[model samples]
Target: YNVTHVPYNGLAPALTGIRDGSVQACMLPYTALVKNLNGKDLRVLAVQSKARLPWLPDVPTTGQQGYPEMDGNDSFVNIAAPKGTPEAVIAKLEGALQKTMQDAGVRKKLEELEVQTMFMGSRETQKWLEDDVRKFSTIIRDAGLSTK
Candidate 1:
């Protein structure tokens, strides 16, 4: 299939194009389309995840939809600080973040926004970031993408 790429400035315009029939479809983050999906303005054919999102439990994952290769693109939210930040400050921040994640109201709000909260300590987050960089580096090379 010959595909033409049409870039939009942001999620709003891309979603507007889809709604106004200027574009047929788009691959966007579930959070970006959560409101539209709930409002019945759009339909999701499949999610590009290994498992269905909790917010869109009925939607099939790419793997379940016969596109297992499309999985492994999950995004995450992490907190970072300057390289020279003190370890005590880092621990305090991580503790506060984890506590916030445990709060019922915070979790509910995050769920409403279609965000999954996964709190990790400093060491775990460092490992996760390193792994993600290595994984995406391989993916970029395989896809012939270049920073230049």
Candidate 2:
């Protein structure tokens, strides 16, 4: 399929464009489209997660639709410090962050927001990112997408 990219300032405008028929489709977060999941006008073809989303259990995944290479595209948030930050401070922050994630209120809020929180320490996060870059680098290169 020859698809054209439709740029929008943000999710709201993208949703508007789709609603107005200015664009046929968009890649929107579950939060952005949750209100319309049961509406007749909006149709979700697939979710990019490896398995079905708990919130959208009826929606198929890209992998389930025979696009397994597009699986596990979970968005993440990262906290970072400058290069010379002390390891002791970093450890303290990591410990605090992990504790925060474990809090029932925090976990409940995250679940309500439809986010699957997977906490990783600094070393684990770094390793995951490096491995992702190597894996997607080849995919991007193969798809003729620029890495620059």
> Which numbered prediction scores highest in TM-score against the true structure?
2
lDDT of each: 0.82, 0.85
Model 1, residue 94: what's the lDDT? 87
Cα misplacement distance, residue 12 of candidate 2 (Å): 3.5
**C-alpha positional error of residue 11 in candidate 2 after TM-score superposition, expressed in Å:** 3.1
How close to the true structure is residue 55 of candidate 1, measured as C-alpha lDDT? 69
Residue range 41-148, candidate 1, lDDT tens digits: 999988887788876789888899777867756667777899999999998998899999999999998887778777889899899779878877886687667744
Provide the TM-score for each candidate, comma-separated. 0.79, 0.83
User: Any runs in candidate 2 off by more than 4 Å, and if so which?
Assistant: none
- Each prediction's total of clashing residue pairs, residues at least 3 apart in sequence or on different chains, is 0, 0
Count of backbone collisions in candidate 1: 0
Clashing pairs in 2: none
Residue 48 displacement (Å), model 1: 2.7
